[model samples]
Target chain A: MASYTERQAGSRLADYLSERAQVLSIALFFAICILFFSATTTTFLTTGNLLNVVRQAAPILIVAVAMTLVITTAGIDLSVGSLVALINALAAILMAAGLPWPVVVVLMLVAGGLIGGVQGWFISYQGIPAFIVTLAGLSILRGFALLLTEGYSIPIRDAAGFFWLGRGEVLGFPVPALLAILVAILGFIVMLHTQYGRQVVAVGSNMEAARRVGMPAKRVLASVYVVSGVASAIAGMLIAARLGSGSSNAAQGFELQVIAAVVLGGTSLMGGRASMTGTVLGTMTIAVIGNGLILMHISPFFTQIVTGTIILVAIWMNTRLFDRNWRFARRKPS
Target chain B: MMAAEAQATRGRGDAPLPPEPILRLRNIHKSFGSHEALRGVDLDIRPGECLGLIGDNAAGKSTLSKVISGTYIPDVGEIELNGRAVRFSTPSEARDLNIEMVYQDLSLCDHVDVVGNLFLGRELKRGPFLDQKRMLAQAETMLAALEIRIPRLTAKVEKLSGGQRQAIAIARAASFEPKILLMDEPTSALAVAEVEAVLGLINRVKARGVAVVLVTHRMQDLFRVCDRVAVMYEGTKVAERAIGETDLQELVDLIVGKGGH
Candidate 1:
C-alpha cells in the first residue's frame, strides 16, 4: 500500500506559540510601555488617570475594532478620520435644526453607511483599489465637514440623554469606555466565531479561491468598509456629545491612530490575520504613551515622534521577527 | 476539420460498450478570441472507471476539461449528464449537478485552517456562527476516509507540505460525493512517494463509482490507474484506446501527434 509518511507532529505548545507570536510580542511591548510609564510618572498608575486614559482612548478603540476587520481584508480605510469629522459636524447641525437628538444619531449612522457603500461600490464592483477610493474619500469627506460648518465649531445644546451616552458612568466605569469594551468584545466574537468573519479572512487571503469555492468574495470585501463607516459614526457622535459641540477639526489624524493600534496589536496590513485582544492592548499602549508623556512634563509634540517610531518598529518586527513560521525554540532533528 | 472528424469517428468505433457514462461530451467547441481552444471534441466518462486525458501542451486537453467543469462555456455542442442534456453557464451550476474539479493550482486558501479551507464556501453555521467543532469532526472523517494523514486539522494550509496540501484539495473534492471529478495535472509537482499516494487515491475514487477524468503528461501514471485513455491534438480528440490495448509509447506518440489516424 502506498502511503504518505506524515510529518512528525511538533509539540502543541510550540504550534500555539508560533501561531500567536505576533500577538504575544505586542502584549509584551504593551506591558513594557505600561511598566516604563508607571515607573517614570507617579500619576500614571493612579485609578483616576487610568479611567481618564480609557475615556480618551474610547473613540480610537471603537474605530480600531472596525479597522481591524478592514485591514484583515487587506484593505485600508483612509477616510475614517474624515468620516468621523463629517458625522461630528453633521450631527450638531441636525440637532441645531431642531431634529430630535435620537433621530439625528440614527440619520448620521445611515448616512455614514450610505457614503461607505458608495465608496465600497467603487472599490469592489468597479475594481478600483481601496487606497485610491478611500484616499479620495479622505479629501472629499473632510471637505464636506469644512463646507457644512464653514470651518466653524457647531454647539449641540440641551440634549442630556445624548450627552449621557458619552459621559454617563455605568457600574462605575466611564460610558464611552464601556461602549468601547462592548464593541471590542463584539468584534472579537464576530472575527473568531462567525461565518462572516471566515468569509472576510478568506476573501483577504485568496479572493480568487474564495470565489471559485462559491463565496461572495466581492460583497464581503465591500462590507468591511460599511463596518468601518458605522464605527466612525458612533465615535463621532460620542465625541460631539462629550464636548457639547462639533468641529471639522475633531479627530484630526485619528485614522492613523486607529490603524497604528490595529497594526500594533498584530493584525497584518497584508490581510487574512488579525487579533482583537492585540488591538485592545495596542490602543491602550498608545493611549498610555500619550498620557504618560504629559504626566512626565514632556513636550506634547514628542508624542507624535514616539508614535511614528513605534509603528515602524512594530511592523518591522511583525514581518521580520514574528513571521508565521517563527518558533520560540527550534526543535531538534529527530 | 475533415481529418479531425475522421479520427473522432474512428476512435468512437473502437470504444467498448460499458455502463452508461455519467457524463458525455459531444462535438464540443470553445473559442477564445480568434483561437479555437476546443474544436469538435467528443469524450465519455463512465462511473467506476478512470479516463486518462493526454495531449501535448495547447492540444486542447485543459480546455476540454475546463469546458466539462464549466469554467469555460462551450461555444457549441452538447453535454449529457446521465443521458440528459444540460447547459452549465457557471462552475457553481456544474458543482450543483455533482461535478467537481481539482485545479492545477489546488485553489486552497493559504491563511485558513485545513477544516476552514475544506468548508470554505459552504461553511456550517449555527445562527450566523461557524460551527467549528462540527466542521473539525467532519474534516477528520473526510480525510480519514481518503486515508490521508495530516498531523493537525487546525494548522493553516500554508503550514502543510505540498503533498499534504494536494491531498487536502483532492479530499475536499472527493468528499463532495460528486458523480464526476476532473483533476488537472494533480501529480505534476509531487515527489515519487506522493505520486504513488495520489495514484492510489485515484483508484480508490474510481472504486467509489465516480467518473474520473485524469489530465496528465505522465504516461506511466495512466497505466497504473486509468481504464481507458483519450488523446487530443490541435483541439480535437484524435484517438481513444482501452488501457490494456495501449502502451506508454503509443500514448506518447498520440499526444505528440505522431500516431497515424
Candidate 2:
C-alpha cells in the first residue's frame, strides 16, 4: 500500500507520448518501406500483394499481442513459439482422426489455455521466475510436439476452409487482419475497462502493495499467462491452416520475433503498462519490414538486421525522451 | 486509579463526558521471548471519542494498538468489542466485526486513484468488473461528509500533499463504517500546518460516532484531541487520567517510571 511507488506527475504524460511515438514511428517506417519498395519493385504495393503481407502478419500479430501482455507483468514467455508448434501438431492429429472442425478448434484453444495455466501457475503461484517457467516450457512443449509426430510432418487435405482464416478476404481485407483488429480491441477493453485488467497492471506495477490490500495476486498473474497461451494456440492454428501442414519444426524461433514485435511496439517487458494498439503497430511494422526486404531483393537474413536496428533505435529514443521528461537523468556523482 | 477514572466516565453527559466508553481492556499481558511489550495494560475507548496514547519510544503504544486490533494475538487477556468478547487472528477478522486500523505510512497505493485506494483491499465490484464509477462517487461522498477539501477524485495519491494523503487514508478507514478505528501515529512526518489539518480530520472522525485509539508520541496532539490521556511506561499503563487533570510533566514522569524511585 504505502510502499507502492507513485510515478511523478507528467511522467504519465511522458509515457503516453512515448507509447504514441511508437505508433508514429511504425507509421513512418511503413511509409518508408512502401516508398522504397514501390519505387524499386514493379508491383510492390499491389492490393493482392499487400493482402499477402497482412496474411503473413496475422499469426505473428496474435502471438505478439499475447507476448505484450505477458511482458507487461515484467515476465516473458519464451515457450510461445513451441506452444504454436505443439498446437500445429495437435491440429493435424485431431483433424486426421476424423474430429469435427468445431471440436478440433475447441480442443486447440483449451490446450493453449491449459498450457498457460500450468506455466503461469508455476510462475505466479509457485513463485518461480517467468523466464525459467517459460524457458522450461519452451523445451518441454517442443519435445512433446516432436514426440507426437515422431519428428515428422503431417499434412491436412481437408483444411481447405480453414485456409481462408489465414488468406480469405472480406470485402477485400484478409480475415486474419480483421481478426487481429478484433483481438486488439478486446485486449484494450479488458486492460482498460475491467477490474481484472486493472488488477493485472496493479499487480505488475507493485506486488507487495497488492498483497497487503488482500488482492488475489496469484490469480491475476496466472490469468495473463493463460491469455498468452490461448493467443499462441490461435496463432498456431492460423499458421498451420495456411500451410495445410502440421510440423514440430513449424514456428521455430518464432518466440523471438513475437517478442521483438511486442517490445518494438512499445510494451514494456518489465511489466505494468501495455498498449494493444502499440502491439498492433509493432506487428504491422515487422510485417512491412519483412515484405519490404523481399521487394528489395535483399537476402532474408537482412530482415532481422533491419528490424533489430529500427527497434533498438526506437527504444533508445523512447527511453531518452522518457528520461528527459522526468528531468529524470540519473547523474552519477562527478 | 484506572478503575476510578473508567467508572467516573460512565456518568451522564457533559461531566467532561468522555463520550460513551465503547471498548474496555483489562490487564492485557503479552510478551515476546524475554521482552514484555504489554504488561498488564488497562484502557477504555468511548464512542465518538479520541483517546490519546502517549509515552516515550518503546512505551508500547503501537504494540498496544496491534493487540487491540488483532494484528498480533495477545498471549494473555480478553478484549471486548461493544461489551462482547472478541479474539482476532487476522485484521480482516477484526474488520468484518467493524474494526479498522490505519497505519502511519497510510498504506495508500500510489498507482491507483483515490477511490480505488479507498476500497483498496476491499473493492466494490459489479458482476465481473470493478465498479470504478460507483466507488469514486462513494469516495467523493465520504470526503464531502467529513467536509475534506480534495480537488478531484481522479487525483493519484502521489500528487497529493502530506495532509491530503492522510485525509484519504483516514477517510478510507472511517468510510468502512467501522465501530472502532486504531490510528498509529497518523501525523508523525507532517509539517506544522499539515499536523493541524490532520487534527481537524481527527475531530471530524470523532464527530462521526466512531471510537478511535489515537496512538502518538507527541503530547501536544494528545492534549489537543484526546478525550483522556493514557501514559504507557515500559509496556505498562502507569497512569491514565482525564486530560484536564493531567500535565506534560506528570505524563513524562509516568513514561520514564519516575526514575530511581
Candidate 3:
C-alpha cells in the first residue's frame, strides 16, 4: 500500500481542527502575549510575578477544567460564578454566626454540590439548554449572595484559620495554589483514566452515536456541571477567605475569563476533546495579560480590546487550519 | 427446495397460495402521498435462500429495504412472518423478530473498538456493568468463524479497511443470531479485493442457514453470490429469475425497463 506523506498528515491535522479552529488560534495568541509581556514589562520576567500569575490562575484554572468538560459537550454553565458566590456567602454567614470554621467549610462544599445537582438536572435531564438554565441560576444565586450580605461585604473579623486557606503559604507558596494544582491533576486523572471521562467526551463528540453505543450521555453532561458546581463553591470559599470577606461579585466576568483560558489552551467549544493542560495555561495567560496590562498602565478598556482581539485572531487561525479537513466531509450538500 | 419444486409442477396458477409463503405480502400498496414510492409493490423473502434485490435509480430499493428494517412503515401493507401478522413500530421491534439490516454506513460508531461496536445498544451485561471480556470472546469467535483476519480485537472500527468493516457488520448481525439478514449495497464502496473478501463472508453466513437478501447495483456481483434474483424497477419487482438463467444485459433491461419487453 502507498503511504500517507507529510502532506497527508498535515491535511489530516487541518481537517481535525476545522470544527474548533478557535482553540488553536487562541493558543497562538498566548505565545504572542507572553512574548510581548516579556519584552516590555520590567516585572514580567521575574520568577516572583510569574509564580504570582500561576498562583492567581490556580482557582480559575481548576474551574476551567469543569468548563472544558462542559464546553466539550457543547454546553455552557453561567451559574459557576454565582455558585461560588452563594457557597462562600453561606460559609461567611455560618462562620460569622459563631459556627466552627471547619463545619462552615464542609457545609459550603455541600451547598455547592446541592446547587450543582439542581442546575445539572435542569440542564441535562430536563432537556433544558445549559446556557439558559445556568444563566437563570446565576441571576438567582447572585441575588442570594446579595441577600446574605445585606448590601455589604461579609468581612471575617478574625478568620485566622479560614483565611490561611487563601493566604497561608506551604513551602513559600500559597495553600490555595497548591490545592488548585492537586485538583487540576485530579481533573486530568478523572478525564483520562476513568470510563466516565471517556463517556463524557464520547457524548460531547456525538450524542446519537453515543446513545446508539449505550453510553449515558445526559448523565455525563450532568456530572460535568456537578463537578464544576462543587469546584466553583470551593473556589468561592477560598476567595472569601483570601479577601477576608464574602463577596457577591468577587469573580464578576470570571466565567468568561475561564472559558477564554480553556479556549486559549486549545479546548474546543464543539465538545468531545478537552485539554486540561491547555486550560491551566489559558488561566495563567489571562492572569499574566491582566497583570501585565496593569503594570503597563493600559486602561481597562484597552485591556478588554486586547483580549478580545487575541480571541478573534485565535478563532480565525483555528478556522483556517480546519478548512483543510472539509474536503473529506464536503458532501453533495444534502 | 422440494416444496418450491412441487409448486412449479402444479402450475403457475397465480392462486391465493398454500399455507402462507414463509413471508406473505397482501397486495402491498405503499405510497408517499401523491407520489407513490412502492406503488402496490409486493415481495416475498423465503427461508434459507439468498435473494438478489436489484433496481435502477429512484426505483425505491432503499425505501423498501427500510420498510423491512422498520426505518419506514409502508402506507398500506401487511407483513406476516412465520404465519403471524406483525407491524414493526421500530427497527428494534423488527430486529426482535429475527430481521437484521446492513447498510453502507454499517451503523458502527467509529470511535469505539470492535467488541464495543458489535455489542452496542444490546451489549451483554454482567449486572449493571458491560461484560467486556464476554463480548470480546464472543466477537473473536464470530470473526474467526467468518475467516476474517483482523489483528487487533481492541482496534477501532475507523481504522478498519472497507472489507474489514463489512466483515464486522456481518459479524455483528450474525451474532444477533438473526434469521434473515438484509444487506443494502454492502459492496458499493469496496475495493476489488475487499469485495471478494465480503463475497466469501456472505457465503459463510449462508452456510450457517441464515437467509440473506442483498440489494445491489452491480450485475456481476449477482452472478457471483445470489442463488435467486428479484429485479425491481420503479418500486415493483418486474422480473424474477434463477441466478443461473439471467444474463447481465437481461438483468440491465429488467432494471432500466427494456429486457421484459
Best by DockQ: 1
Candidate 3 A-chain TM-score: 0.86
lDDT of 1 by residue, B31-95 (tens): 99999999899898999888999898999888898899887899999999999999987777888
List where candidate 1 sits over 4 angstroms from the true fold.
A1-8, A324-334, B1-16, B26-36, B74-78, B83-85, B191-194
Give all TM-scores, in the order shown.
Answer: 0.91, 0.80, 0.69
Tell me the whole-model lDDT of each prediction, alpha carbons only.
0.88, 0.78, 0.74
Better of 2 and 3 by lDDT: 2
Candidate 2 local lDDT, B1-261, one digit each (tens)? 453344235422455434546888888988989999998888888887778787888888888987877667888888887888878876667777787877776767664667777887777788777788888888888878766667667755665788788878777777777888888888776667667766776767777887778888777777677677787888988777776666677778777888323
Candidates sorted by DockQ, best first = 1, 2, 3
lDDT of 3 by residue, A108-214 (tens): 77878788888889888899998899999989998988887876777776779998998888888878889899988887876654566667766776675565344
Interface RMSD of each: 1.3, 3.4, 5.2
Over B26-75, each residue of candidate 3 has an lDDT whose tens digit, in order, gives 55656777777787667777665577888888788878887887767878
Compared with the true structure, what per-residue lDDT tens digits does model 1 show for residues A1-334?
A: 9997757769999889888877787788888989999998889999999999999999999999999999999999999999999999999999999999999989999988888888888988999999999999999999999999999999999999999988898888999999999999999999999988898899888887787777778899999999999999999999998899999999988988888899999888888888899999999989989899999999988888888888898788777765555343444599
Candidate 3 error regions (>4 Å): A1-32, A97-129, A147-150, A157-162, A300-302, A324-334, B1-183, B208-223, B226-261
Ranking by lDDT: 1, 2, 3
**Clashes in model 3: which pairs?**
A15-A325, A18-A322, A21-A318, A25-A314, A26-A314, A72-A271
Q: After aligning candidate 3 to the native by TM-score, how far in Å is the CA of A320 from where it should be?
A: 3.0
Model 1 clash pairs are: none
Chain B TM-scores, listed for every candidate in order, come to 0.90, 0.84, 0.85
